[model samples]
Target: MGQLLVVRHGQASFGADDYDVLSPTGEEQARVLGAALADLAPDLVVHGSLVRQRRTAELLAAAAGWDVRLREDPRWNELEDLAQFAAVSGSPDGLDRDGFQQWYDAAMARWTGGEHDHDYSEPFVGFRDRANAALADVADEGTVVAVSSGGPIAAIASVLLAGDATTYGRLLPGIVNAGITRVISGRRGLTLLSFNEHQHLPPELRTYR
Candidate 1:
């Protein structure tokens, strides 16, 4: 049996020119989280290919004083459907925050309701299959920390919650930036230990924007 820690990437430059980079405060938040986890000494560290996610993992590894050996898995990346919707809707660059959110909500609702096919984006079923496969691969004797975005993390949690896709839509918004969720592997399967933990961070460091 093993333990899996799912960590949301620290705060990024939300509503900025580029959303892939971590903010200065985000780096510090990662460092603090690293310090909090140093004693645990996880066996494996994984993150998505996105720069913000990778950078957070790097910062955590540095703070823990460990030589980082990170594995990048695209399956852990967030949904790209919103980006496609934005493009399709002819949203202008850098000023479509509200529009993007609206599109995202509608797309997610459609996704959860099984109205969209894989051609639309990474469908819910596909996301679950790939994410579960990745989780299964990492279930071992030691702890594994996976750094990812809100969407994937929420999907994983939704699966763990043993509910339908609609539940995920209701649960995702509650996840805070840089939050931690614990899932333990056991004889039966993976069991969720905790969800969206941010007790280690002060209020100032918990901002998602």
Candidate 2:
């Protein structure tokens, strides 16, 4: 049997100019999770091409004292593009975080609703299929750790649990920063062992954005 431990990247620079970068809190979150998982000593460390995902993998591997080289897989990339997705749903100007979240939820619904596939360059189905492909490509008889974003993580989970991608957007909001989800491969194929495990984080470190 093989195991895939997927981690959502730590807290990112939400309101900052570059949202792809990790915040100070995000850095500490990675360090903490690294320390907690030091005993696991994963066979491989994989991450999305995004800066934040890459940085989290680096920090976690370093903190865990593992010499394993990190692997960059663009297939593990995020599906959400805040500005782009919001605009697709007709978001108004000057939306606060709360307001933007509201619009983003609506946007995700519209994007996945199947009626407006033409609106998005990459439809929701495409995102789900690619993410699932990426996961299948990485599965092996050893423990593999992948650092990615909430969108892809939720997408994979939705497919495994619900049998498709239509409901992934609904699972997005609950994915905390640096959250852990475990999937196992056995005779039955990929079985979701868990989703969104964050007990390693303290109350202050638990953030979803």
Best by lDDT: 2
Model 2 spans with C-alpha error above 4 angstroms: 163-166
lDDT of 2: 0.87
By TM-score, the best candidate is 2
Q: By summed lDDT, which 10 consecutive residues of candidate 2 come out lowest?
A: 83-92
The sequence of per-residue lDDT tens digits that candidate 2 reaches over residues 47-125 is 9999999999999888888888689999899976655575576755698878876887677777877788877878888
Candidate 1 error regions (>4 Å): 87-100
TM-score of each: 0.90, 0.94
Residue pair clashes in candidate 2:
none
- Each model's lDDT comes to 0.81, 0.87
Clash tally, candidates in order: 0, 0
Cα lDDT for residue 34, candidate 2: 93
Clashes of 1: 0
State residue 88's C-alpha deviation in candidate 2, in Å. 2.9
